[model samples]
Target: MPNCQTESHPPATTTSPPASKAPQTTEALQAEQAPVARDWRAPSQQEIAERKKQLSPDQFKVTQQQGTEAPFRNPLWNNHAPGIYVDIVSGEPLFSSKEKFESGTGWPSFYRPLDPQRIVEKHDDSYGMDRVEVRSKSGDSHLGHLFDDGPAPTGLRYCINSASLRFIPAERLAAEGYASFAYLFPEVKQVLPQSEPTSGR
Candidate 1:
């Protein structure tokens, strides 16, 4: 979210004309902020285990064991294609190509999540350094760390593990049941490669 200064607005004067209608009620406020239906949800544990079987050892380690991959060597680090990144375990949409940026960290970096509610952050004290660990809210897969040093509009960098995410290219969104996100990359070509063009996810 963009940073903004809190501006003070003067309170309405009692001398002002009477209001034409009542202010928004509690129910109205709740309705306005209600959660919307999501296109995907967490997969079953059985499904997750099956998916794990299909993943590479490194992928499993990074995502399941909270391990970090070597910098500049991971596949998704240099991916520049237009697509949405989903949790490998649950297939929930995590980040969009639009939010991805080159952070020189040799990992997939995003300025923000595709859906903020899909991610959860925890205090990570495993390493010698202090950091906020990121994870999938539903799948509980370890993604990576978050840092405040990032470009605007949101000063946040979500450095993620490639193995923890699956890319659904704009061209293949519909085929992969992510058609709702196709609009985000309207200019992206419909033709897609059989596999992720840059690296394995």
Candidate 2:
């Protein structure tokens, strides 16, 4: 008997296939390119309390207690300067001087807020009258009442209280941490000095 021992064949090498990437959906691509959302949440109770402590009695009343300031007597009511109004409590941009107009309401009136999303409107049924009340989205400050009696276009009047706002003058926008809005004011071109009148002599 011939004992023939056949050599076992060497095991074949195995290789893993490359992974296939799944195609991105339209929604995913859109989300990736979308701008990051801003943090607009309200402040904590402690922060609110601290802000209240720093506010004047009038400011505290209008923002915290939802009280109204006298129409013609409040500051900023007749302010016609180029600037933006911010939340007294949260420093959130609310309205711009360009939107403000003479509404004869004796209060700071605007056709619309700087950003409509920054304002929260609610049905205010107090005092036996139905009115739309506007509030700061982040600060939750009671701005004032909104009425339909306004100029063309929006036909909406935001009759806001001056006490609930802090004005950031255009000249001081950068110094006051609002430099992003500095574009609202363009630099005034210097007029060339008039030639001396010696020619007339």
Task: Highest TM-score: give the candidate number.
Answer: 1
lDDT per model vs. reference: 0.70, 0.68
lDDT of 1 at 10: 30
Among these predicted structures, which one has the highest lDDT?
Answer: 1
Q: How well is each residue in 48-146 modelled by candidate 1, as lDDT tens digits?
A: 878878878987887889988766566787788889899888888888888787665567777678767777888887746677889997788999887
lDDT minimum window of 10 residues, candidate 1: 1-10
Q: Which runs of model 2 end up more than 4 angstroms from their true locations?
A: 1-45, 188-201
Give Cα distance to truth, residue 14, candidate 2, Å: 86
After TM-score superposition, the amount by which residue 61's alpha carbon in candidate 1 deviates from its true location, in angstroms, is 0.4
Clashing pairs in 2: none
**Pairs in steric clash, model 1:** none
